[model samples]
Target: MKLLKERIMRDGKCFEGGILKVDSFINHQMDPILMKSIAVEFVRRFASTDINKIITIEASGIAPAIMTGYLLELPVVFAKKKKPVTMENMLTTTVYSFTKNRNYDICVSKDFLRKGDHVLFIDDFLANGNAAKGIIDLVNQAGATLAGMGFIIEKAFQHGGEYLRNAGVRVESLAIIDSLDNCEIKIR
Candidate 1:
């Protein structure tokens, strides 16, 4: 993940209030080569897990999740921020967005997620673990086993990674930010 760390240092923007904006390459305007490399790394990290499906929250998480799913040759399912009218038999949960500073009701159809399936969750960033918790809730409701979680960038200064790891969940992050203080990016 050294390449990712270097890219973050070069292109990532650090703002006050512990925000690291990686829109230039990671999120908003994606770099496909880097994304593929990240996906390859995730596949390598979770290769031994019993994963049958890949899950992620919509929008920002979609790119990395899809890339990972493609690399693993697994079906990817993303939870919709707003439940569509046609969605039925869906499992829903509330997740607080760290960047948007709002709560979102994320939902996914039970048809895609079901019992006896092991799943890997992938996302662009892990800030406070709210979205991860929400995915865990949905997976539990579906009786699906969470094989592991992968994140492109993890704010290690936050509690998300620690909380998930302490809870006995396998979490892998490509680039971990030690601190984003005074508009400086510190990678761990």
Candidate 2:
């Protein structure tokens, strides 16, 4: 987690509208080694949980979720933003992306996620937490138990993490940023 925080400080960019761009090493062009470490940390944090599957929303969350699932020996299921024609009887949820300033209908096939599954939701960033909330809604709709939620970076100022925790969900974030004011990122 220390390394991750350091990396964020070194390479992360602060933009207007409270955005922290980490594409250099995270969202866009990924760092395998760093991702591996993140996966390891997630696994370590949830080692005691009975995690049957890993769930993440498509685009950025895939990398860390797959890595964690691979390390945990579990199947990784990602919610697709665009529904394919082949996908039938899909479980769907609507999520609003704060950064994108829009809503997306994310779906996953019923075959991948099922009842009696202990799921761990993973994501690259937790801004408004709508994406993670949508994933949790899918898990709930499927009657799956949400074991926990993991994040590579969390914007503490947004209070999404607190919202989930207040709702009795176990949330873990590697790097928590307090603010992005004046083109500077402050870690909590």
Off by over 4 Å in 2: none
Q: Return the TM-score for each candidate structure.
A: 0.97, 0.98
**Candidate 1 Cα misplacement greater than 4 A, ranges:** none
Clashes of each: 0, 0
The weakest ten consecutive residues by lDDT in model 1 span: 95-104
Residue range 97-183, candidate 2, lDDT tens digits: 777779889999989889999999999998778987898899988989999999999999999998999999999999999999998
Looking at model 2, the pairs that clash are none
TM-score of 2: 0.98
In candidate 1, what are the lDDT values of residues 1-188, reduced to their tens digit? 99999999899988889988899998799999999999999999998898999999888888888999888789999999998987678899999877788898999999999999899999999889999999999999999999999999999988899999999999999999988888889888
- The positional error of residue 66 in candidate 2, measured at the CA in angstroms, is 0.9
